[model samples]
Target chain A: MMVMTQENLTSKERFDKIFEVEFLPQIDALYTFAYHLTYNEDDANDLVQETYLKAYRFIEKYIEGTNAKAWLFKILKNAFINQYRKKSKAPTKVDYEEIINFHDEENDTNYSTHTDLREEMFQSMMGDEVTNAINALPVDFRVVILLCDIEGFTYEEISKIIDVPIGTVRSRLHRARNMLKGQLKTYAESLGFKDKRSKD
Target chain B: DYQELVRKVTMYLDNELSEAEAYLKVLSQEKSFREFIKSKLHRRKPSPALIKSIKDKIKT
Candidate 1:
């Protein structure tokens, strides 16, 4: 959080300083988020560009010393919701029951044997799979999870950014995690790492 | 019970709970829960290429 003295500098100077100091460091994180939300590289770039342009135009109104990332995220989230997400639907839907039943079928496989391999394999596989699973979440859940889990924002910060109550953030994060866990479980089973503890 | 367990594990994973409380809650769970927490805590970061693309976009 960098503070700009409103009285000391010209508006353009202030904007440039803020952009250089506060916004630039967070650009990568913001783009990653936009990319995940849009699921298209080009669209993600455009969305992030638009977000920055809006943030710059409205720069004078932004209070100094506030959470810059959250402010930027608010701008980005609103842009995504009002403009982009409204025009698109999820590419696919996965049934949780089907995943669970599939895990049940693989109950005979041993988890312990794969526990060592699990770490390395999962580490390599998780980034793409997690991104895919997150992108597949409903709009609300996806936003909440991205803010809380991926971007590492606090619940209060997310509340302010998304203009939602803290309770909603909690519930949405909970649901999102469960959905993610279900997806990961299915992914693990597909890789033949059965939950041996299920038998116990 | 499963929901409660999930909530506890999630809170613990996020470090939202106090250490003593998290320890107590986590101690009561099955071995799988512990393993789950360990795996999750150690999950890999996003790819460098993904991160690089983001940085490149931001720089432009």
Candidate 2:
């Protein structure tokens, strides 16, 4: 059997190993998330670098074999809020519209009898505008939508990440989706969405 | 009723629905909204330079 020389690995070597194995893989995801949060390539790069720096600094506290991605994400998110958010001009929040008003505007819930193929056609139309709509949101609302809709995190996972109660996550998600629907309403209508049910 | 439908839209997209038919119905009712959210499902990774930069910056 080969000798297991544990002491041969220096602290920097060990740190490099963990960083390469654990942290490096999450760079793209962290950058993508950073991009969505900051809405600027340069800011995203800065945010991601800051996150990696922090993660490296506190690498000793990180537990191996756990969810490294989530841990990195938590650090990135905190870094985004603590660093990027404070420098941005948008106020942290707006008044919560107790009722989601988008659906209330045109509730002609008369289901369109469009074929699956036609539905697919409409789905194909929903590309770039969705990205624009997502980016247009205030940072706080945008984060929830990105975490839930884009990243596919569950409400509980998001609650844990954002350090909010699950109920808050739910409400925030609800509001964010409503806001997106409102922003995309015009674009959606132009694609033969509104009043198409009347024809069908 | 539309708010109820909106909730269904969120649940359906979230894969929380038990029945596929129910999800399709939710999609059918909130057609535009469903399509919009589904479109956000695609992936986007960072550039190679960003990855290299992270690697470079992490060194002591």
What tens-digit string does per-residue lDDT give for candidate 2 at A123-198? 6655568777887787778888888766778777788888999778877888887788788778777876662322
> What's the CA error at residue B17 for candidate 2, in Å?
6.4
Q: Once superposed on the true structure, which residue ranges of model 2 sit more than 4 Å away at CA? A: A1-14, A89-129, A194-200, B16-24, B29-35, B38-42
Error of 1 at B41 (Å): 14
Q: Estimate each model's TM-score.
A: 0.64, 0.70
- DockQ value of candidate 2: 0.31
**Candidate lDDT values, in order:** 0.69, 0.73
Going through the candidates in order, their DockQ values are: 0.17, 0.31
Docking class of 2: acceptable
lDDT of 1 by residue, A97-166 (tens): 9799768756747655666586876667556655567667889998887776667788888999999897
Q: What are the chain B TM-scores of all models? A: 0.35, 0.47
